[model samples]
Target: MGRGRQKAKHTKIARELKYDTYNVNYSALEKELGHPGDDQYVDKWADQYADDDEELETA
Candidate 1:
């Protein structure tokens, strides 16, 4: 969302999971989730996944 929030962390995770690259191409992860844009969208999707994961774990 805003700056100075460790945004690259999500991108790294996504890359490890084969979601996207530095150039931000929509990998299978983005396609499945219908994510648009480049790195920005990847970051947003990653955050969403993290939030969802937390919710699931808590549930």
Candidate 2:
């Protein structure tokens, strides 16, 4: 397709998305936003690499 035609099609789709309204799942939104705490993840190699990271920082 030509450039103008492609741009027009994209603009039409963009307008539809901008104006479209649909039902929102508030429970899912709440669940997604409720968790703010860190997962308390531990890296296996973090202890071994800690010395290397410190040396690089010092240099």
Candidate 3:
């Protein structure tokens, strides 16, 4: 495409992104933000540093 047409298309897309508003799925948003729906998850490394804490306490 021509430079003018290319620039115009880019401007149109930028304007749409700048001015557009859409409905947000809040529950999906919460899940994405790390509020898990259950407590069954466990971190395998959660206790990995626990031994270090005891070393410091004894020293």
- Number of backbone collisions per candidate: 0, 0, 0
Q: What is the TM-score of each candidate against the true structure?
A: 0.23, 0.49, 0.55
Over 1-59, each residue of candidate 3 has an lDDT whose tens digit, in order, gives 59999999999999999999988999888878774468678677977666777889999
lDDT, each prediction: 0.65, 0.84, 0.84
Q: How does candidate 2 fare on TM-score? A: 0.49
Kindly report which residue pairs in candidate 3 clash with one another: none
Instruction: Pick out the ten consecutive residues of candidate 2 with the lowest summed lDDT.
Output: 33-42
lDDT, candidate 2, equals 0.84
Runs in model 2 deviating more than 4 A are 36-59
Clashing pairs in 2: none
TM-score of the candidate numbered 3?
0.55
Ranking by TM-score: 3, 2, 1
RMSD of each: 19.5, 5.7, 4.3
For 1-59, candidate 2 gives per-residue lDDT tens digits of 59999999999999999999988999999989675568666577886655777789999
Q: lDDT for model 1, on a 0 to 1 scale?
A: 0.65
Put down candidate 1 lDDT per residue, 2-42, tens digits, no spaces: 65456787777767879644565668667877745554534
